[model samples]
Every structure is written in C-alpha cells, then in structure tokens.
Target: MKYVLGHKNPDTDSIISAIAMADFLGDGYMPARSGDLNKESLFVLNEFGIESPELPELNEVEGFVLVDHNQEAQMFDGLDKSKIEMIVDHHNLGGLALLSPIFIRIEPTGCTATIIYKLYKEAAREIPENIKKLLLASILSDTLNFSSPTGTEADKMVANEIARETSIKIDEFAAKMFKAKSDLTGMPISRVVSADYKEFEMGKFNVGIGVFETVDPAPALERKGEIVEAVRELQQEAGVDYIFFAVVDIVVDMAYLIMPTDKEKEVATAIFKGDLEDDVLKIPGVVSRKKQMVPSLQKYLENV
Candidate 1:
C-alpha cells in the first residue's frame, strides 16, 4: 500500500493535503501525517467528520507521495529521496537527485490545496464534499482566510467554489477556524514554538523559523518569559545558526518576534525594521513569513 504524507510538524495544509491526495488517488493510497495535529487541524477534521491521518510506519509503506512541502529536511526523517514516488507541493523545488523519472508538481500558489483542486479539474474527477471541505480548510489555513499577502486570486476562487457548493459562509467559517487556531492556551512553550515551525536553507545558514499565528496575541504574550527560555533551549537543540519564533497576530497584521538572547535581538533588529522592546521585536505589516520575511532574510543574510 502506498502512503501519502506531509512534512514534519504538519500544518493544516500539510495534513489536509495528505488526506485529500490519498482520496484523489482512489484505493491503495492511504493518507498519513509526519507528526501530530495541532488545535486547528484537529478542529477542521472533527468539523468535517473526517478521521486524522495515521503516522506512517516506514516499513509498512511502499513509497511516499509528499504534499505541501518539497524540502528533504522537512520530510520524514528516515525517508530516502529515491523512495519519493511522487510530489505535489507549492513550495520551491528542492534538491532531489532521483535516478528515475518520478511524478512531481510544484506550483507557485498560495496553497497546495489550490493546485490539488486544479488537478481534480484536469482529471475530470468530481470532488466529494469531505474532500472539498479539506481543500477549502487547507487553503483558508495557509492563506489565513485570504488576509495573508501570500494569498492570490486563484486561492480565493477555489475556496469560493468549495464554499458555494457546501453552502458554507466564508467569513463565518473563517472566523470559527481562526478562533480554533488561536486557542493555544494549555500547550507548552516548546510545542507552541514548534507547532508550525520548519527549517530552511537560507543563504548558507540552516535557519529554523517558527510562527504561532493567532487572532488574539494576548494569551501567548502572557507566557512571554517562558517562551524566551524555551526558544533558547530549542535553538541549542535544533543546532541552527538561529531559531526565530514569531507570534503573528493575524487580525492585527503584526508580529512579535521572540528573540531568545541579546545576540538574536541585535541580529533581528538589524534585519527587520521593527522596534525591539525588550526581548520581543514588534514588527508591523509583516504577517506572511514565507512571502514577506524569507526573501529579505535571504538577501540580507547572504554573506553572513
């Protein structure tokens, strides 16, 4: 049996894409997750009456069909590149030296689910209501209900089609989704930091970046002291040049950069045009980390 899985520390797009892809492929292709689901992903699954994907036991699978992410570092830890039978992602193409021709689709879209919807159209396959819910939820999660700069018209159109078919109010549904995502009340500092985190190869530096997108930043801010200490320990554990954790207020379009130390704060102050009030760097109009922050970071940190 073939297993479709997403990157580690699976976000909504990653989790839903895996489930949707496996369904699109019909029988024999089973959905799987690289890690546990977060509050929002679990909310969506329960809302749609869909079961969460199980963790793929490597030896029990034939090969992988990765969704949402293409980078090897983000992939299952022991997964071999050669075992990647197919890939459907919206991220930049990574270094994959496959000896054989493998199926791959990488698009510059706001969400991987958007591309998957296109695939369904091309194949003349009908999308089920559950699959449609998964796609719509994934798009909304990634694009932050179209509030994110990474969102495009394509994503909006696809989401609209799903919403209309399901008779779901976009704004109302999005409000509920965002509310579910923002409820990170009891999660530990470590899990909160790593929940939506990923490592990237940025200008020779292996940077580990994490973001906790919330509607109300007050709850996370309450744990600010513990978060700083957690980030410090996580940086040491990740062994990256830097571990940057940002608490992004989606509703306010603002970010509170958690600088673990003076050195991180200084470097962040240099990189971002933001105010460093204590260990937290307050950045305005910097919501989408992928589109807004990554490019500038790559340019500025090229030499360093």
Candidate 2:
C-alpha cells in the first residue's frame, strides 16, 4: 500500500494536505499522519466532518509520498529505510536524500495545498466540496488568512477559486476557524507549546520553534511563567540550542515571541529589530514562522 503522510506535530496544512493528496491519488493511496493533530487541525477536520487519517507504521508501508515537509526530523521514524516515491513540499529541503530519482514537486507557495490545487486543474479533476473546504482551511491557516508574508498571489487566486465553488466567504470562515483554535483553555502548557512545533538545523545550532495562533494574546500571555518553564524543559529534553514559541494574535497581525534565554532574545531583537520586554518581544506584522522567523534566524546563524 502507498502511504501519503505529512510532518509530525501535524498542523492544519500538514494534516489537510495529506488527506487531499490521498484522495487525489485514488484507491491505492492511504492518508496518514506522522504525529498527533493540533487543536486547529482537529477543528478543521471536525468542522468539515472529515475523519482524521490513521497513523501508519513506517515498516508496514511499501512506499510513501510526503506532503507539507521534507525534513527527516519532521517525518516518521524508519521512513529513511522505506521507498520514497514522491515529495510535495513548500519548505526548504533538509536532510532527506533519496537514492533514486522520484516525482518531486517543491513550490514556493504559502501552502502545499495550493500546489495540489494546481495539480487538480492540470488533471482536469473536479475537487470535491469537502476537499475544497479542507484545502481552503489549510491555506488560510498557513497564510494567516492572507496576512502572512509567505502568502503569494497564486495562493490568493486558488483560495478565491475554491471559495467561489464552496460559497464560503473567506473572512467569515477564517474568523470562525481561528476562533475555534483560540480556545486553549484547559490544555497544558507543554501541549500548547508542542502543538504546532517544528525543528530546524541552523548552522551548528538546533532550533525548535512553536507557533500558537489565537484571536487574542492575553489568554496565552496570562500563563507566561508556566509557558517559559515549559520551553526550558523542552529545550533540555530535546537538547536544542534554542527553543522559542510565538503567540500570534491573528486579529492584529502581531506576534508575541517568548524566548527563554538571553542569547535567543538578542538574536530575535537583532533579526526583527524589536525590543525585548521581559523576554517577550512584541513584533509587528510578523506572522509566518516559515517565511519570516525561520529564514531570518537561518541568515543570522549563517553569518555567525
């Protein structure tokens, strides 16, 4: 069986892209997730009445197609030993090296679903209504409702096309989706921090970054002490050089970054040119981690 999977700590884009790809590829392909779903992804799946994909055992899959991410650190264990049939991602390539040539589609679009949407057009296949909603949600989530720096005109065009077919207003639906994910009421600090986490290798430094998107930042900020403590624990456990989390206020298009160490704060202030207040930097118009945060940090690391 051919397994279609996405990165671990599955975000909305990662989870939805896996499902959409599996459907597009037909009977032989099975959609799967490498890790547990975040609150946002779960909300999208529930809102659209789509069932969550099963987590696959790496040794059991005959071949695989990766979506959303290509980094081995973000993939399932034992994946390196399996046959990689295809890779469809939107991020920079990492340590994934295949022995043979395979079908690979890596685009600079904001979301992987955008590339998949284009593939649907190329194949002349009609996108199902449910799948259309899923793709729309993924785009909105990854692009921060078209406010993200990573979002492109192609992403807007695809989203508009999908919206017309589904009769879903972009702003209204995005508001509802963001509202659903904003409620992190009972979730533990560790769960909140690890929900949408990702790791990057920046020069000799290992960096782990997490993003928590909410309509208001006050609720998350209220638990600042516990959140910072959790970040420290995570850094120690992962043995990473830097551990950071961004609490993004979707309404105002701002991000409140929590950097546990002084060195991280200095690097962040240098990259974003913002003052750090109590180890939290309030950065304006900095929403996309993939587009802004990661790239800026990588450049800084490269220099130093």
Best by lDDT: 2
TM-score of each: 0.97, 0.96
lDDT for each residue of candidate 2 in 134-166, tens digit (9 for 90 to 100): 999999988889878888999999999989988
Q: Write the per-residue lDDT of candidate 1 for residues 1-304, one digit (tens) a residue.
A: 6889999999999999999899898888999999979999999999999998889987777888999888888998888778789999988765656789989998888999999999999999999889998899999999999889989899999999999899988888888988998997788888999888888887778878889999999989999999988888888998988778999999989999997877667668888888878889999999887887777776667767
Stretches of candidate 2 off by over 4 Å are none
Displacement of residue 100 (Cα, Å) in model 1 is 2.6
